[model samples]
Target chain A: MLIAKVIGTTISTIKDPTLTGRKLLILRQADIDGVPFGKPYVAVDTLDAGVGDLVLTAHGSSGRQTEITKNRPVDAVIMAVIDHLEISNRVTYRKE
Target chain B: MLIAKVIGTTISTIKDPTLTGRKLLILRQADIDGVPFGKPYVAVDTLDAGVGDLVLTAHGSSGRQTEITKNRPVDAVIMAVIDHLEISNRVTYRKE
Candidate 1:
């Protein structure tokens, strides 16, 4: 899993039928210091994460393991909302 | 899905039991022109792609959708081997 911040939501009127009713959020990958990096991409939200919320994102088929995404064509999914993150025993980010 | 090239293999003696007997290939993301880009990462192979083979890779939970990867903890999987790739009506790569 990778750390990311939900940036916004995406709505498409015409898309795969399986994607209907799924919450698609824009995610910006974040480094340990909570700084955003890499290109922003769309991710299916499974944990009710909101914009500005730090999330743990699973990529590839693991994104489909969630009940809501099973058998869907999604490639990325938000699996958990991060409360805090630590590296090398040092706290790096704390969700507020 | 994204295009990538298998670069090598990975062996782990200690890993999730579900991952046993699964072939793990290292993949380098490639652009439409077949030029490698971005950081290399590991991906489970479902299509028997070999090192240097151009492949289509699915990320997130979609990687686990394959029969061999179902219920596994993997995040990336190679789903198809490319015979050729075209962009703007021009062939960019053709398997030799």
Candidate 2:
């Protein structure tokens, strides 16, 4: 699952207690017609998407399917926030 | 596992009653050619990657590498910081 667009954020008060209080953003990968690909990585958010919102990004193990990242030191998470996005049928986004 | 970028970020006063403090960033998909395709999306960061930093993100179960994210609710996570990236017969980005 990939359709991103939240372009900035990085904060760390010394990490690695299994990544205590996770929150780091920086993604730029969009496909399925919207365009804007390549270069830009960093994911660790569980919904509550903002900053140009067009969400619904879950990769690998389904980004853990959240129960607050299910098991532990999380990966990518944003379950769902996209209301409408069509490719061949058009209607790229419609979540007003 | 796509080649990703960092164009921006977002945050809130969270702390995780599960993930009350997970920071979110937007992302767009990129090909190995270093071309920007699609629109934009998001990812949860694992490293202190910068706006221009190319990272190695883990998908599915791979995102659950770290002890923090091991066997948890994570889906995608940055496994390596990408010291240098090469695609075909060339060097994409190297460690400075």
Candidate 3:
């Protein structure tokens, strides 16, 4: 799973039929501190997460494990919304 | 699919049971010209690709579509060895 920050959303008209009405969001990998970086990629959003929310994304086939994304051509899916992050027992990030 | 260059190999004894005896190679993403950049990642090599070879990798569940990687825990797989790359009617790279 990648710790990522939801940066924005995507609107696609002509896409795989399996992806119709799916919510695809733009994301960038984030560090444990919840700071975002790197090139952005799109992932199917199943959890009603909004922009600026730090979330956990499952990639590959695991993205299809969810009922909403099953058998879809999508490669990434937002599986969890991060409430906070801790490293070595020290809180590094907390949802605002 | 990503254009990547195999840089090295990995030797792991303790890993997911599904990955036992798999050939996991290290790779870095490459441009159409075959120049490598960014961080290195591991992928199951199903096509006997070797170091210095520019190959195409299928990521996510697509990596599991192959017979060698089916149901495995890996997220990436080398699916094709690139012989050459062309862009805009020009060959950008050719195997030596």
lDDT of each: 0.75, 0.57, 0.77
lDDT of 1 by residue, B1-96 (tens): 889987655443433445668877656789887777765556789888887789998876677788997786567788999999988999999888
- A1-96 in candidate 1: lDDT tens per residue? 456789999989999999889999999987655677889999898767889987756676676767778889988787656565544345666777
Q: How accurate is candidate 2 locally (lDDT)?
A: 0.57
lDDT tens per residue, model 2, A1-96:
466666777798887676677766777765544454788776677666666555555665556556656555555665555555443345555555
Which of 2 and 3 is ahead in lDDT? Answer: 3
Best model number under lDDT: 3
Deviation from native of the Cα of residue A32 in model 3, angstroms: 1.1
How many steric overlaps are in each model, in order? Answer: 17, 70, 3
Residue clash pairs of candidate 3: A60-B60, A60-B61, A61-B61
**Model 1, backbone clash pairs (residues 3+ apart or across chains), number:** 17
Error of 3 at B66 (Å): 15
lDDT of 2 at A56: 51
Go through the candidates in order and give each one's DockQ: 0.11, 0.12, 0.08
Where is the poorest 10-residue window by lDDT in model 1 chain B? B9-18
User: How good is the docking of model 1, as DockQ?
Assistant: 0.11
For candidate 2, what is the DockQ-based docking class? incorrect
- Model 1 residue runs over 4 Å out of place are B1-96
Off by more than 4 A, model 3: B1-60, B63-96
Interface RMSD of each: 9.4, 8.5, 10.3
Against the true structure, candidate 1 reaches a TM-score of 0.54
